[model samples]
Target: MTRLDAVVVGAGPNGLSAAITLARAGLRVQVLESHAQVGGGLSSATLTLPGFVHDYGSAIHPLAAASPAFRTWPLHAFGLDWVQPDAPVVHPLDGGRSVTLERDLYATADGLGADGPAWIRLMKPLLDDWEGLLDDILRPLPRVPGHLLTLARFGIRGLPPADLLGRTLFRTPEARALWAGLAAHSILPLSTPGTSAMTLVLALLAHAVGWPFPRGGAQSLADALRAYLEFLGGEVITGVSVRDARDLPDARVVLVDSSPRVLLDILGERAPTAYREALTSYRYGPGIQKFDYALDGPVPWADSRVGRAATVHVGGTLEEVTASEAHLDSAVSDRPYVLTAQHSLFDPTRAPAGKHTFWAYAHVPGGSAVDVRPQVEAQLERFAPGFRDRVLACTVTTAPQLQAFSPVFHGGDVNGGRGDLWGLLSRPVPTATPYRTPVRSVYLCSSATPPGGGIHGMSGHHAALAALKDLFGVRRGE
Candidate 1:
C-alpha cells in the first residue's frame, strides 16, 4: 500500500497533464488507467498492415498547439515535433472543384470568390487578437479573464457558420459550402451559435499556427506528456479500472478523467444526491462510428487539391449538412457526416513509401450499434473515385467499442459529453467549481468538464490547479 499526495485516474492527455502539473508543484502523484496503454483516444498503432501506422483516435491538433498550457510546458524540448502540412483542410464540391484553406489568410480569402472581403474582415480581427481572444475562451470558466471585453465583442451578435458565411462573404454556392465544411468540424447543427465560433476559431488557427500533427504520430504527444509526468517522480498504473471509491488508494487528492456517469457509479451513495441526479440527467449528443484503413495508396480525388490537405470534410452542401445533422438531432443516424484525416501525406513514416493510411468517421444516433463503414466508403467514393481500390484493408470500430476504450466518450460521443449550448453549460452540472465534486479532495478533469472535449488538456491542468488551491493551499504558481 503505497500512499501518495495525489492519484489521477485515467492517463489520457488531461490526466497526464494534471499529474505532471501536480508533480512539478512538488507533490507525489500516481495515475491509474483502465486501458493497457496511455493516451486514450490519442493512441497510435500499426493496426491493419505492417509499417502502416494508424491514429487509434484523434489525428490533428489545432487546439493542442494553440493551448497555453501545452505551449508553457515546452513539449518540443522533450522530442515531440509538431508537423505542419501544406493545407489544413480541403473541401471538395459536387463538381470536380474544391476549396483549400492555406496557412495564409489572404490566399484563403482570395479563393472564396465574391465573399472574399467578408472572409478577411471576419477573420482579421480575430487573428490579430487571437492570443487575447484565446485567453478568454480557453480560460477556466467562472473566472473571467481580463480579455472578457474583447471576447464578448467577438461573440455577441454573432452569425452561425452557415449563415455567417452565406450572408457575409459567400454568395457562390462553392464558397458557402466551403465554410460549411469547416463549421461541420463541431458536429453541431449549422445554425448554432457556438458552431460558428468553432469554425472561426479553427480557421483562425489555420492561419495563426496551422493545424499540426506529431512527427512520430499523435501517440507521441501522449508519450511525451507521460514521460514528463514520470520524470517529475509521478507514476502511472495501467489496466487498473476504478469502479468504486474503495477500489482506489487513499490520497490527499483524486481526479477522475472520466464522464459524469462513471463518477456517479464510482461514488454511489458517497456522492451528493443532487450531483448524482444531475449525472443521470446528463444529455449526450448523437454518437459516431469510426473507421481506420490501411490503404494501398492515396485517395484518387478528381480534384488534385484533396491530396494536399491533412483532413477533408465530406458533406455535400450547407443545407445537406444541416438536414443530416437535424436528422441526427431526432435520433436518426444521418448518412454519416464523414470527417477524414489522411496523415500519410505529411508523415511518410505512417505507411510504406508508396502506400498511405486513412482515418474516417461519421456521426450517428447515440447508442446505435450500426456499422457505418459501407456508407462512409460510398460517400468517400463519391469524391475520390476508385476509393475502394485504395484500401488494402480496414477496421471499423462501432460506437460500443469506442465507448469501451474511453468511457468518457459515452455512446461514442467524440466531442466528449456534448457541444450544444445547454449541454455545454449544465453538462456534468452547473457549479462554481465544475471540476470539483461531492467527495472532498476529488475532481473531474476529463473533457466532460468545461472547455469540453479536445486534445488541449486544459481541463486537466485547470482541475489540478483547483486541487492545489483547495487541498494544498496553492495557486497557479505566480
Candidate 2:
C-alpha cells in the first residue's frame, strides 16, 4: 500500500473543503465520511413524503455564497446554481405588517420607514467593504486583521449586545424586529456580547450578496464541492467511519472535521493530557428542535409580502425574539423565534408541482428531548394564518437527533460549538492556531474551530492551510 499525503475524516462542508485545499496544493488527499453521501449538514432527504426534498441542516446560505475560499473555487461549474430570492429576509410583525431586508441597500432602508436613515448609516460603511470584512472575520481571531479600518468600524457597533444595539440604533418596531431576527441567528441570548457580530455580517451579506440557496437543495452545494474536490484529484470514500487512528489510511497528515470530542477519540492517548482536558471542558450553547414540513401550499402569511424572500424570521417584536432566545433552558415560548426557509417557493425542484416545503427550527436547551411541536406550530400559525392546514406532513428533529446526525452539531448547537465571546475566543481551547492539535500531523478542522459554524467552510480552509504550511511548507498564494 502507498502512503497518502493527507486523509480527512468526515465529508461535511469543512471536510471536503480541507481535502480540496490540500489536493489543490498538489497533495494526494482522501475524504472519509460515515454517511452514505457527503455533506454532513448540507444534506437533503425525503423525510416527510415522497417527492418532497427537505434540507436536513442549512437551507439559506448567505455565508457560503460570500466565503473567500468558495469565491475562488469554480463550484458553479460543478453543478452549483444559486437561487437568490427578491429579498434577503422578511420579519413579520402583528397587524399584518412586515419589514424586509432587500437586496439593495436603499430599498431595504426605505422599507424601515423612520429608521431608514439609521439603517443606512449603520450598514452602508460595512457593506462597502463586505468582502474584506468577511475575509478578516471568517477565521481564527487574535491575529493581524486584513482590513483594519473595516474591522475597527465593525467592532464599534458589533461589540455591544444585540438587545442593547438594536434598541439604541433603531426606534421603530419594524427595524428593531428586523435587527433582532438577524441577531437571534446566533442562537444566543440577545443580551450576549459579540451577538451583534453575526447580526452585522448577515445584514451586510444581504446587501452585498442576496441570501441565496442552491436551486435544488443544500445537497447540490455539497455535491458541487465534492465534485470540485474530485476534479482536483481528491478521493472521497463514504460509508466509512474513522473511530480511531487505525481507521485512517496511512498519510503524512490527517485532518478531523468532526467535533472536538470525536477528534479526541480518534487520537486516543496520542493527544496530550492538557489538550484532552481543554477539549473536554469546551462548552456548547443551546440546541435547536428543527421542524421540516411538506406543505400542501405556500405559507398563507398575513402580509403576503412575506413570500418575497425565501427566508422569513417569524417572531413578532424585538422584545418577543429577545425573550424567546433568553428562555432556552425554560419552557418553550408560544412565540418562539422560528427561523424558516421556504425554498420550494422559488425552486420548483424542492417539491412536487403545486406543493411546497417549509424548513424551521427554534433554540432549545442543549440535548433537550422535549417535544416543542405544539409551541412551534402555534408560533407559525400566529404569523402565517392557516399554517397548520397546509402541512401535508411534519418531521420533528429533536436536539439529540441533530447531534446523532452530525457530532459537530453537538447537542444540536448547530453553530458547531458556541458563538459567545469566550466560546469564539477559546473554541475547543484557545491557541494561536486552534486547528493544530498537539499530536503531530493531526489537526481539527471542524466548525468547533474559529469562525464557528454556518456553511462558510473557512474553518476547514484555514486548517488545511495550516497543514499545508507545516507539512508541505506551502503557504497561501505560494
Candidate 3:
C-alpha cells in the first residue's frame, strides 16, 4: 500500500505541471499516465518516418514563452531549449501576393501596408501588458480581478460597433486577412467576443517573445518536466489507465487530467448527480483531422514570404475564413480553413538533412469520419500551388482516430470542449471552482477547466493549489 500526499492520474502537461507544483510544495506527489509516455499533447515520436520526430498534438510554444507559470518554472535549466524562426506565419492572398508576420511588429505591420498602423495600435497595448492580460485570461471567471479593466481596454481599442473586434480591426482586405489569420488560432468563429482577445494575445506574444520550439521536439519539454518531478522525489507511472478510484493508490487528493466523459464512464454512480448532469449537458465543439508529413524539402510557395514563415494560415480573407468555419460546423466545406506549421525551418534536427516535417489540421463536425486529406492538401495548394509534390510520406488522423489517441479530446474536440462564449463560460462545467469536482478529493485539472486549451499549464497549477489548500490544509508559503 503505497500512499501519497497527491496523485495526478494523467501525465499530460497539465498533470505533470500539477504534480511538480505539489511536489515542490513539500507534498509527496506521483503522476500516473495512461499512455506509455508523458506530455499528452506535447509528446513526440517518429510518426511519419525514421529520423523525423513529429509532435503528437501541439508543435509550437508561444504560450510557454509568454506564460507566467512557465517563466517561474525555469524549465530551460532543466534541459529545454527554445528556438524562434525568422517568420512567424505567412498568409497567402489572391494575385500571387502573400503577407508574412515576422518577429518584429513593425516588419509585420509594414507587410500589411495601409492597415499597418491599425495593427500596431491594436496589438501594442496588449503586448505591453502581456503578463497582466494573461493573468486575467488564464484564471477562472470569478477569480480574475482585472476583468473589467481588461475588457474595457479591449472594447475601446479592439472591439467595434455591435461589439465585434475581428472584422473592424483593419480597413484593408489584406490587413483584415492578417487579423483573421491570427484569430483563427482559437478555432472559433471570428464573430465571437473572446475570439478577438485570443487573437490579440497570441499576436502580441508572437512579437513579444516569439513562438519557440524546443531543441529536439516538444517531447523534450515533457521529458524535462518529468525529470524535474523525479528530482523532487515525485514518481511517474505510465501505461496505467485508471477507470475507477479503486485503481489508484490511497492519497489525500487526486487530480484527473482527462475529459468529463472518461471520468463519468468510470466513476459513474460515485459522481454527484449534479456534476454528472453538467458534464452530460456539456456541448462539444468541432472535430479535427490532421496530417503529419515527412518531406524531402520545404513546401515551395509561389510567394517568397511563405517560405520565410514557420506557420501558414491557409484560409483567404475575413469572409472566406468565416464562411469556411461556418461550413465546417455544418459539416460541408469544399474549401476548409487550415493551420499549417513547418517545423523544419526552425529546428533542422526534426528531419534528416535537406528534409522537413510539416503539420496541418482542419476543423470539422464533431465525430466526423471525414478523411480530410484531400481538403487539407487542396487548401495547402491554394496558397502553395505545388505543395503536393513536396510530400514524401504522410499520416492522416481522422477525428475518431485522434479521440482514440487521447480520450481527453472527446469526439476530437481539441479545445477540451466547445470554445464558444457560452462554452468557454461553462467549460467542462460552470462553477465557482471548475477544477473542484463533487467527488471529494478528486479534481479536474486538464484544459477542460477554465482557460480551456492551449499549452499554458495554469489549469493544472491552479487546481493543485486549490487541492492542497482545501484538501490537505497545505497553505502556500507555509
- Best prediction by lDDT: 2
Screening candidate 1 with a backbone cut-off below 3 angstroms (N, C-alpha, C), the clashing residue pairs are 115-169
For each candidate, what TM-score against the reference? 0.96, 0.99, 0.95
Local error of candidate 2 at residue 443 (angstroms): 0.2
Off by over 4 Å in 2: none
Superposition TM-score, candidate 3 onto the true structure: 0.95
lDDT of 2 by residue, 168-194 (tens): 999999999999999999998999998
Model 2 whole-model lDDT (C-alpha atoms): 0.92
Which is the winner by TM-score between candidate 2 and candidate 3? 2
* RMSD of candidates 1 onward, in order: 1.8, 1.0, 2.1
**RMSD of model 1 against the true structure:** 1.8
Task: Identify the candidate with maximal TM-score.
Answer: 2
Instruction: Output the TM-score of candidate 1.
Output: 0.96
**What are the per-residue Cα lDDT tens digits for candidate 1 across 1-478?**
7678999989998999889889989999999998888999889988788888898888999889988788889687777898898898888876778888889999988888677787787788778888778767766667756676667756752434455545465677767777777777776776766677777778888998898899878899998898888888999999998998898898889999888888887778988888888889888877777888988889999788888888888877766666666666545334556889999888988898899999988887777787777778877888899999988999888778888878888888887777876667765788878889888888999888877878888888889988999999988841
Ranking by lDDT: 2, 1, 3
